[model samples]
Target: MKYPIMIRVKQKQIAQLVSLGKRLDGRGLNDYRGIQLEVGVVGRAEGSARVRLGKTEVLVGTKIELGEPFPDVPNQGVLTVNAELVPLASPTFEPGPPREDAIELARVVDRGVRESKAIALEELCVEPGKKVFIVFVDVYVLNHDGNLIDASALAALAALLNTKMFNYEVKEGKIEVKPGYKPLSVKNYPIAVTFAQIDDKLVVDPWLEEEQVMDARITITTDKDGKICALQKGGYGYFTTQQVLEAAKIAKEKAEELRKLVVKG
Candidate 1:
């Protein structure tokens, strides 16, 4: 999230437009751009999804493995999330270890699902503390226009919905795979909405141009029950109390629209 020279100049211009009650892309302060989502995009993965938000593109794949549950949560299954920012995604992204930006993206998406209780972990448990299904959610940033957080979250949720778990039977302390398969037990739907602060205005779904100039960003995740599940704020900017409330209202309104796209397997 380092600001380059050109990016800083563009951000200043966007801030000026925000002060005039306008956005760089001419979208309303609370309007989201068109979203495109597709499930089962990767044939090799058990479950996969791709999401495009404006110019940002993200892909998610889910893989399940049988393993012992965590000592603290033996009765429940485990959910592990990881994110990768390929060097080809953006010039700033390197080829080696993950940077802070990638870590933050993974945390934001993971918190939304974990806090929302979207997955029925207990259903994934096979034998209390002995064995359980561990769900691995991997997110890859194919393109970095802006707003990777929102795109990644959408892809993760969609991939989870498309996942199919193989039936298993425990015999003589050994787990055997059954012939039939069942869809992952998804208990709730969670959607994330991101807002960028430019000057004094908060704009929803900021494109790369606007993001380069914005001062701060906020993401809100809400469940199908209309309950706020998680909140994350990024960048070195300040938000007033009133602005935070206003952003929440906008996020709640937009979340419902996006939640409709999460298909059940």
Candidate 2:
């Protein structure tokens, strides 16, 4: 009873504020909240990174293991991404198995990294069809402040950048692990930019409150070449052609700006 009424009141106030090109957090429509990144946090994992986007916090860990390659892509390594939505992150999260939201979150980040070809899979191949190194990317959501897609993607890329490969030698059809390690061969960098449509205006990196009030949302991921590698649309709303194009233009610029933070060059 009162719950529904409170929701409506909040929605109205948020809509009215966005209608005037302002956000509840005092940011412009295109401005994103402050982002903080830390790499090499987990000592045991091959690579690890944590990202703080406003109040949203996400951590990613990368582990490399030896495994057989797929029959079709025998000459390439395999990349698997998994995401966990801890119940403690948000009250809405449950302690059960993986939910649809968690699956979607993992897929979105996976697509951005896969489509961009950021990792050199062929280089990880050991013996063509027989042996290859498998890279596992695990995403851990420490806090749910909205825009999980962008935050996870940022952390994933940062983790990959910090990843290290074990030094080894192929001796008589077997891999002999050495004492040193080399950095993973990372090529392109992909950055995801998310927008939420509220009151006919698009808000960049919408926080939890804006997400609740947004009519529809879209995420555009761009590679280092300023090309869109992946895009995800959510909510029950449509965007005009001009709006899509406008978002693309912004995606390119924002991707570059964000990439600099992860790549450190």
Candidate 3:
């Protein structure tokens, strides 16, 4: 992935500025771009949300249905995640099956929610082993400024928070769907914070240009208790133990800040 000559020159300028604690966009080294969140954007979906982080935008939709339980987790509900990088979102994105980056995005977001136990899946069980609820979380990238991982994760969590599941009843040893709907059971809020390493500086919420020049990227997902739930590292660069620890500390604070925008009373 070789960039153009102009891009290479710009990358050098960015690195020089970063060494002096300055960014091309005039943001502080650790400062994040502006974020905006909207839930219940898709009326047809059981749950849905849209998130904007700087120029990046993503939409997440949650669909719930009754299905046979998994062999091992028969008593608990199931959760599946899928992500699509729409070709129109970015020039580099192509239309086709899921790519490696898209697959990794889904897995990272899934791990954050699953490991944090954000949703009360047990309550979705219609029967002990015969039937249970299945939640499908689908993420779509509407814009690709950079840092899709964090934006997609935020949208998924927000959609889950706005989810409303249909009521159900059991009769004659069979589960029956009811008309009314009830809010999905949620237990925790897990948010992911991402940083891009350019030269020796680690910047929060990298934009498109910064991402292209970055040496590495790290995303850390944390729960409300400020405990790390999941982590993903990208690019070929390495991070020292001290760098990882510092990233976690920064993730905790930023996660809390982002949580306030999506979580409601």
Q: Pick the candidate with the highest lDDT.
A: 2
Candidate 1 lowest-lDDT run of ten: 256-265
Please state every model's RMSD to the true fold in angstroms. 1.5, 1.8, 1.1
Backbone collision tally, model 1 = 1
- Across 1-265, the per-residue lDDT of candidate 1 in tens digits comes to 5678888777777777788878778877777777899999998787899998887899999999989999999999999889999988888788988789889999999999999999989988999998999999999999999889889999999999999899888898889998988888888888999999888789888888887777889999999888899999998898999999999988998999888877543
The alpha-carbon deviation from the true structure for residue 72 of candidate 3, after best TM-score superposition, in angstroms, is: 1.5
Residues 1-265, candidate 2: write the lDDT tens digits: 1234566779988899899988889999888899999999999999999999999999999999999999999999999999999998997788989898899899999999999999989999999999999999999999999999999999999999999999999999989999989999889999999999988888899998888778889999999999999999998788998999999999899888898899874
**Model 2, stretches more than 4 Å misplaced?**
1-5
Q: Candidate 3: which stretches are off by over 4 Å?
A: none
How many clashing residue pairs are found in candidate 3? 0
All candidates' lDDT scores? 0.89, 0.93, 0.92
TM-score of each: 0.95, 0.97, 0.97
Clashing pairs in 1: 11-213
By lDDT, highest first, what's the ranking?
2, 3, 1
Q: List the residue pairs that clash in candidate 3.
A: none
